[model samples]
Target: MITTDLNIKFYTYIYKCHPHLFSSLARDGQIMGLSLRVRRRGGSGSKKEIIPVTSCSEEVEITVPSQFQCPISYELMKDPVIIASGITYDRENIEKWFESGYQTCPVTNTVLTSLEQIPNHTIRRMIQGWCGSSLGGGIERIPTPRVPVTSHQVSEICGRLSAATWRGDYAACSEMVRKLKMLGKESERNRKCVKENGAGLVLCVCLDAFSENANASILLEEIVSVLTWMLPIGSEGQTKLTTTSSFNRLVELLRNGDQNAAFVIKELLELNVAHVHALTKINGVEEAFLKSLNRDSTCVNSLTSIHHMILTNQETVSRFLELDLVNTTVEMLVDSENSVCEKALTVLNAICETKEGREKVRRNELVIPILVKKILKITEKKDLVSVMWKICKSGDGYEVEEALRLGAFKKLVVMLQVGCGEGTKEKVTELLKMMNKVMKMNGFVDRSDSSSIEFKHVKKPF
Candidate 1:
């Protein structure tokens, strides 16, 4: 038997695979309450018997009335609390909202004078009564809410964890990491409590201290796991988490660490992609990524991430090109994976926007053939076509000759006939016109009919 939550994934699968059944289920109010089973014959011949398999449909449905639901969680409230803005919410949800540094009630949008949550005893009693009544449906009754963690408690824990880390007390550090992970997992309110009380800063300190220590990988992994949940706090928090030492350590891990460490670093980079300009500042970052690519051609995630990072600024692009990334990109253009080809094309197109980049591309021997072969196969046809056109417009006679010799003109004509977007068709037509002019000037016959290429000659300076 299999059990799962009736979440968005379940609904999406049903909607996509069985739309009519989903519609009927929704009309019959069975959308919120599903129970499905698949029976198959098991064992051989005389011992054959039916075995039932259960899916997400086995989960019970809890239909809480909207009024009884917390605005933040949209679940039934256990301890309803009123705020200064005269709006009521679940104690845990509202506390998390305020602890995360919000100053207004979620519903009223009114400025709050105080963050105190006054417990609504009457509402709690009414909800309990409702849950016990016949209208409660199959939903379980709300239990008494536990008292939230105080800031003082979190600060004390941080001090101990920091001391343990600095003293090289791995055991103590691991224990604290375990406790903090538990607290973070318990509720969003607890997570905010952990962050606001310096959990993130403490974790960064531990990461810096234990990074170089021998046999510290386990401890570092624990710290990273705990820190992962405290992310995206505030700008100050982000700045502290992304300090030079910490950022470099993360990059180092990305290059050499185990799978778990690599996962943590990847996630960190993704979250702080905008703020990690320091990654580009580090020497050999591009070289290291290219080396990894050379070692493993199928690593699409690393390839895509590197391309995204390079596309962030022109300086990074220049540095990337300086590392001879153009040839590597050309190699990737022919990769069997669609994603590899697409990302390689995106980076190549970005590089072609600069004069030096265009010059380098025009000089490469494999540039034209690789692009011609992959242009129709890759999803980024527009970028590929744009790069080809730019190279053709480079005004180098040899570049134009090489492109024509490689059958680029025929590909453009085919793209036009097969029907692409109007913008793409216009660009393709212009290229064909330019290629036709060049071929005629060189005493080569324009085998492509000009009438079929339907666009006025928009002359661009060669």
Candidate 2:
């Protein structure tokens, strides 16, 4: 008797035929494919098995029928599309399934088009930037008429950065800069975020080339941002914050944090602790201007957020005091608007915590309690905790205790009990205990009530 034992076998296979051929066994598994098992021709019970057959279900490439048109657009696919393997493979709607980058199916959220399985050469080439890639100088150099750098000319610059002759010494460099100049004019028209950011890179490289030789006409802030990325990074804190050399240049940059100045201001912000000292010296001028002028909340708000990072200068402290900024912030504390209120409060909050701020003119005694009431009344965002704690310490009389009664204990506890660090939490605990004793002696908590108002400060050991 012809008999063979086969292990599991594939679903589709080329198989050995026997005379009076036996039937093929069924194959089954997780994926929609095949496997194989084999049994040898008649033999002793021991090891009577045939070798397993191999099977495959490789995806078949097919010429899409021209008659097939997308149901959504009624046009030939801008590209080839993959239909679902198991679902109703609607040929007409094939184009909808293939987007340029995403793998997720819009309808089912299942991954239908994995990146590796995609074999459409035409689809791949369209999205690839022709500029030689950062990998192995893959960009190509293209020439164009003289104009400013913009999105339209980005392709040209990308191509050059990848070229062997991408140096300033090359004849192509001037034309690259010229095309970049032209592209600059057209940038407002480039709608895509990627293209806009690409224009940024082109501007960045151009600025670097110009800046290395101290190109005066090059836009300064653009150079800073490019340097932020391309500049050789210094020791963690080594980069100068405010070089006397660059101090005036940065002050000119900080003349305002206008659209042109934001990047340079950010560079100044990144200065190491020592550099921040330099910033204070440089910023002394702005502080003087701040002291001289009466700016509205917007100006104060901008200065406060970035200025707190400068902790070194006496002039910085004096300028803040000259403006009598503490009282000016009250309106924001009372404002109903969202960002305006928060920003104003933030400036006020940062001010109160500074040692210089404590020495500056204090708010009228009433304002602190008003802020306390507001803090106790509303939901507490983590940022607002420093604001409250600083103001609470300055509160004069029953205000601190009243805060305890008004659920301030829980807020303090959260900031302490569940707080991550030992610093603020321990300080908060001390503040709370001190306030509890002061309140109990003042008779704020009745002795008989079970409110956990135990004031042990009154009891003394003999």
Candidate 3:
């Protein structure tokens, strides 16, 4: 009783002068005894009991069990994984060991037949239980080990996707595609592992198989979204995607408001310029581009995509005209920023490359005027002047007469004097000559004010 009294007095002194150290000692299980209540300054009228501590001689160090330690690092195994040698080591240590060119187990000294590290769940749980009880919660908890992503897993996923495609199972396809996406996003190593295992080609095949199934719209979106992460696809995958049936199927998805599909198609097109020919054959592709340009947040990318398509496959211009892209593109120029206007003008110019394309554009009253307005306004005048030249060149005189009225003559002159590239300057010169020829045909040759058509600004560039 007297010794206990002395111990209490000593603890009270330690608590008053070095309270934090006392708490630390108590928490580490270094002190073990009866409970005593102590009041803190400004307590909320609450009493908390403190465990009385034993003397220093009774303290024992908490040592990790020998079996719980990794043989490679001789440290507690947080992620215990077993190799082909049937020996367990911490995942990090063994991975480093294998990477350092060692082919044998560090402990057993036996040759390793395979480097695959299987998670030792039994040892991991034992180590976790020991840490929780002995460490008194001082250390961080061991994380449940994550099995490394493997090429085998990716190939299996691809096989499942292929099988699902054969079976026409939308639910299974979506689940597998989402799994591939998740694994790809986990790390760069995992992405490479997935791509090298032919995941991209499998997805393309799945996308092709499901293209005609209206019931698989959600699954199509899931597949396309995954493809975005697996870009720079292989040549085989590219060919699979660019085929007529598959390419048109992707465009059909784009028309159905699948922006991810649009992005995938755009990326695929950029990968191979020759793919644009296939893109042109798709009936709804022009309409898809028009919709994307009007509503998608990445309209700039969409515009550039269509511009490349038209430039690579000029025959698509007639299709664009048939779909009324002339009016839609011209309207885009009205409110679009300079960047968007430049791309819109590019598409229009590509359309003007064809004779029917030119007529369709020239028949739109806004085409010539908007082209003339965009000349000095946009940083790139090549397409703008090119469109103007195409619309007015060899026409039935309506486009040229309209250009003279819209004061495109002076803008053409300014563009020439402003030191544009040789191509743009040449187009500008041709347009001016065309305008003058039309003016002569209209009997403005005798009027001295006929050259007044070259006024500085007709109305406004907008």
Candidate 4:
């Protein structure tokens, strides 16, 4: 009776403590006679296999190595990192200990001189190897851990970079900035930590201090790379960074072929263009902005910047015209994806607000066909119709004639028939009226059969 009680107690313990093994045993109908399997190497050059042993007999014990376990959790250390006190602890547990408002090391109970945790790669590799060899089929191996970086560590790195820049130590500044770039590339969490710890302000200050230094070009590029990841500074930081001097520096870097500087400036422009009240104050910025659009990665942002620039000051439109903005946007519209095409068309409409913009569109031979082609092809019918209306409304009926010849009349007729939003329908009706008037006044007959006119390229939606 005493042996039966002990067996019941053992079964209960297995069910609670090792549910996975218990489930396997129950599935195999071996719950009554408890057994455990441990993997062992068969022989040299032979395959390994699991051998079962009775739990009641001499049971094989699996013990965790003392060094492989965390000092606080006493569990196996997955991500072992050494604190400033020179004691190793798992990254997650140490972070929790710090977050609990303890400035002292959990193991030593002494004040930590610094919260910096360097990864103990040697110990981690040892643990991984032991997990692979000894634990075998019993436990899964520990994955190589991602190095954990705290905000305090990031702040220290930023401080060091700031100090290096202030002391004019370009080499040290370059090294620290590269370190930051490495950390920033490690993970998104690291990037957020860098930004939260004032990396943006520090890097911007460094750029401002060393921008004119001829020897600091490479260092400045490294700073730009790090700054690219820590984009979107807060409003207060935005107000401080988006000054005339900052604009000039970024434009110069952009002209010098640092594409990331363009990206950084793009974010800054997006954050707050309030500082950019005067467009002419910064020279060649419009040209540089237009030039960055040649690359696909920066095209969306460059278009956004141009949109904001034109809206901020209508006079900037003339500058963009001189830089071939109309031709560039027209070319982009043909190959750009839906979102980019929409933005490019929006910019064209914004440009069309002026007489020069309308004249540019009227002169471009491909403008009418491309706009009409987009009618049946693109999804945003509202923007498409809006630009067409602006063109016909501004011209001396020439654009209206060209649009009709390009089958705009048929496309619009089919669009109205298939149904569109009220706004698009209203605009399409207005365009049809303008085109019919232009055709009649130009001695061409407007017949109801135009909708039935077979189009070579556009099929009737019906």
Candidate 5:
């Protein structure tokens, strides 16, 4: 029998009651079970093994270090648990962690001592799952959600950067400049803002009086160099004050102003002119962007920058369409994360955007199958659709005809056929039908294109 304010009572045998048996019941700020694994003692203890209570797995062997012995469990060479810096060698992983030893919780930014329990939902669920499994109840694993970045953040930072520039606040302006430079062309957060016109406000703020001040010139030079190199969006006089649609408005500002055109302009010449031509990195931004892609750990935004660079820059991208680049890019698609795979597909789409890009993709058969896989990701189809459309659009009458003959249409049709209970299949069918209309509009099927032959791609799904 049990008694509580809630009036809930349960019966249990005394033999089942012990600190180890009910350690999970401790609310917080309590040291519990010991894990006799992993940490080893060189000076105080010997080798021992204990099943971890916190891990939902039925058992995990922890090889305790030598010389370390748990005073509470009275176990030697066992698991070392974390309890507010009091490491007991004979303790479990969770127990040691909960001891409040850490300055900050890894999952949550909160300090451990401030909270009775871990602030992270994931950590709590893991603990709960392990506890449930111990009593023969099935453990429910919860998936952690990802945080999305917002353009509002970019605009706010840019606003500060501009304000600092306006007051001759060189020190403050330089710091903001450094932070922005580090963020560079690879930041999805900033680029999205640039696209939405919010980032332009920052550029305008920074450019004012930038040419007249030498210190401000170099600082603004570096910042604009990166933005112009990566973000190629422009319209002549598109600035809030202008009417001309010249594409190099940013680079033009640097060159036309009191800026040492000889300094930043020399560096800007090497950027991917097709996309963001305003940048001037004399040392070579291309090499830098490439290195990021081949890193052991790659970021999605970095990969996106690489793909866009390859797409918008015809000459530089020609180098990527080579056997080496396509091969490496193909492997990148193997990433299970839909965003990573989608970016890789965008790179492929760029390669197939022109006569040369198409030949590169055709020369390599791997790109097709990988693209099919990405398009097949149901939840990720929206991202891939636009890229796929580009690949199809770049095809000339002959290229379009050949691509269909090569079975490209079949792959797209498969996605439409298996669409799970959504209107997506209908949407895909509409796109395909529209493609046929475009061909006709372009005179691909009119009396003008004698070579334009009708391609039957089994119209049902594609």
Candidate 6:
């Protein structure tokens, strides 16, 4: 009787602890002679407890079947495709692997002779059927995959749009551009196909042609919309589209075109630093960019983009200086919002790299004092400190004296005492040392004077 009770206890423990394994065993008809009993305590007016006995039965375990999983992602395949090696994988993953210049099978590791991916119809039907049934574990049914656009189709669309634009077929050109936008927006693969087939070049040519004709203003907007969708494809595509004449035409459009055209120009210029520099070389481009910086609004994103582009190249900085951008940027630094101030400082940092650019900054009287005040007021201090460091490092005696006169020395000392980052602290130390040597050489300070300058705690500007 004791052996039987121990066996019953062991079976009860296994059934509770390893229910899935127990269910599998039970499903196989392996559970035998298992029973359980619980003793009841404290019955009314009873000294001894009563015991109740029960018998256990078999149950089956429901789980996801193995065939529904993809070999690539190890998850249920939403869009399964069979490769040349006769192995199935999720379509998106396989396509990405193929696009990355890998010509081998992901599973078999064998060199693939073809890149074709056939849809796995049979497995998809089975997965759909399973998802529809009660045994699917509440998994939602996967939708059918859309058919991909072919390269040949994209080429035909490009041909139609180019022909229509050349012949001045306004209605035809509009329709074709709309269709191309839809195709390009459909998927990443379609966009790649459109770019590879020379769609960006076609759009640039159309933009030039339309801009030359004064009556084609409506078509210009349409073409800009289509080109905006097709842009930022690749470096190769950007190079093909950003020709000297095309770039000049784009600058003109930015000056005269509406807000939509301005947005497109912003995106195109942001494609690379090369495009930004190229645009800067055009006449009146700097003026157009500076005019766009409005104080009463928060729409300075495009101006910031231009500033980022200018920060990358020193030649662009010199060009901006030639256009008298220093005074405008200094005014912006003093009066503009926080984000615009950050961008202005970034531009100034780059400009101060050259002697001419540094001279332009030093000549501006408001540059130093406004920058010192801004450092105190702005929460973002890294860019402001960098710009100040560049100025102090590059400035001559009069410039450094100007910085000192504007309370720059006091600000640097306070920043050090208030505990800034090691980099900022080191820069401050270097600038202070430079300033001290200059001051002593000018006979303005004596080494024996211990109380020449006093350091104070920096109070919050707010």
TM-scores for all candidates: the values are: 0.54, 0.43, 0.57, 0.68, 0.33, 0.59
Candidate 3 Cα deviation (angstroms), residue 159: 4.2
How far out, in Å, is residue 377 in model 5?
3.4
Off by over 4 Å in 1: 1-113, 117-156, 178-198, 224-248, 257-287, 291-342, 349-386, 389-434, 439-462
Q: Model 2 over residues 268-298: C-alpha lDDT tens digits?
A: 4554455556556654555533432233444
Summarize candidate 1's per-residue lDDT along 424-446 as a digit string, tens digits.
77778888888787888886653
After best superposition, candidate 5 residue 37: deviation in angstroms?
46
Which pairs of residues clash in candidate 4, taking residues 3 or more apart in a chain or in different chains? none
As for TM-score, the candidate ahead, 2 or 4, is 4
lDDT of 6 by residue, 1-462 (tens): 223656656656766687677668657855554432222222221222111123343222233455666666555678888889998887898998998999999879999988888899888888888877766533468888765677778889889988987897878877877777787677877777777788877777676656556666677676676666566656654564566765665556556634555566677667666777676667777656655543223335455656655766556666677667777677777567788787677767767767787778777767766776775667667767776777777766675675565566667777788777888778878878876777777754322322232323322122
Worst 10 residues of 1 by lDDT: 44-53
Q: Which prediction has the highest lDDT against the true structure?
A: 4
TM-score-sorted candidate list, best first: 4, 6, 3, 1, 2, 5
Clashing pairs in 1: none
Predicted candidate 4 versus true structure: per-residue lDDT over 1-462, tens digit per residue: 122546656766776688788678768866545444433232231432233332443335455666777878766789999999999998889978987999998877899888888999999998888867745323457899676568878889988988998999998888888888888788876887888889888888888778667677788778877777777767655644565665677777776767787677767766666655643468888888776776453367678778878877888999999888888888787667888888888889888888898788667766776787778777777777888888888777777886777678878988999899998899899999988887787766444443333334642222
Q: What's the TM for model 1?
A: 0.54
lDDT of 5 by residue, 95-118 (tens): 454455655544344555632221
State residue 256's C-alpha deviation in candidate 6, in Å. 5.6
Q: At residue 102, what lDDT does model 3 achieve?
A: 96
lDDT of 1 at 370: 72
lDDT values, one for every candidate: 0.68, 0.43, 0.74, 0.74, 0.45, 0.66
Judged by TM-score relative to the true structure, which candidate is superior, 3 or 5? 3
Give me the overall lDDT of model 2.
Answer: 0.43
Q: CA shift at 251, candidate 5, in angstroms?
A: 13
Best by TM-score: 4
Q: Which window of ten consecutive residues has the lowest lDDT sum in model 3?
A: 38-47
Error of 6 at 78 (Å): 1.1
How high is the lDDT of residue 202 in model 4?
85
